[model samples]
Target: MMKSLLNAANFQLLWFACILGGDNWAVAAIVLYLIVHHYFFVESVSEWWVILLFVVLGVFIDGALIFDGWLVMPPSIWTFPIPPPWLLGLWAGVGSLFFHCLSWGLTRPWLLSIGAAVFAPLSYFLGADLAEVSLGRSSIATWALMAFIWFWLMQVGVFTTRLTIRRNGRTHHV
Candidate 1:
């Protein structure tokens, strides 16, 4: 089993399954980030935790959205013909993992802020579209504005965290 699992073909197939199962674009973004960072070996503890946390958070956020009726996926899209409660979280995990990976390449606070502002809405829209969620024509613009605000919050949080770490005289690489 271990030998088969270690096969390159098997690994590729597994990644392919993940891509087809959720937001492929977000996954692609993550893969791009990994490639850019030269950390594609999958050996980093921090990287693994980041991926796991993103997925968990996505699931929770999605669950709340479902509970509140803010989002819904039509039955036609699924082979099982019903929206699974865990789907939202799964999507969130995928997206968050992608964004967090991208964050590694972001060295400057302003660049991170702007990049998040632009990519957040695009990522949201792409995820929604992939999941077959209908948000009408104005959804893009509305979500873009919301994404910008959210990006600002994210920037502040990341900036503060980095500052705190720096103040403590800890050396880190981005």
Candidate 2:
């Protein structure tokens, strides 16, 4: 229980690091956070694949939004189309949440969907504002789109993770 709380705090720190630090500030934080997470909090080796899955999903969603002109990111060492690396770091951390801080929500689909719909878009808003990025031509529309995507993402993500994930040689029934 305590570890889950600590993990939640760690995730918040990473979120701030990604937003305030930008890609520049997030490099060390991402590396250190992932290392500590894998060492101390990971419940199963399969969780790494889940992280990869989210990386791809997040990149795809953000990339599609960029292509459709719904989201905009500032210039970075990385080029156009692909999301900035710091954003990828944030996605990885988000994936890691299911096994720890977000575990409680996985079992309650309606609650998870509602919370994700609300908070995920809010996070994007906060991240965009903090990072000084633009949300395409319309912030409201972009946020709504994000809300839709995140609502489905959490619902589907928990479904897939539940079907596949096993912790300590047994399925995580929670």
User: Which candidate leads in lDDT?
Assistant: 2
- Per-residue lDDT of model 1, residues 1-174, tens digit only: 333233333333333333345543435544553453335334334444444554555555544554455556555323542234334333333333322333452366676667667766675566567556655436756576547665764564455445544565654443
Q: Candidate 2 has what TM-score? A: 0.92
Tens digits of lDDT, candidate 2, 108-150: 8779888999999899888888898888867778778888999
Q: Estimate each model's TM-score.
A: 0.49, 0.92
Relative to the unseen true structure, what is the C-alpha lDDT of residue 89 in candidate 2, on a scale of 0 to 100? 88
**lDDT of the candidates, in the order given:** 0.47, 0.82
- Candidate 2 C-alpha error for residue 117, in Å: 0.3
Best by TM-score: 2
TM-score (C-alpha, index-matched) for candidate 1: 0.49
What lDDT score goes with residue 127 in model 1? 56
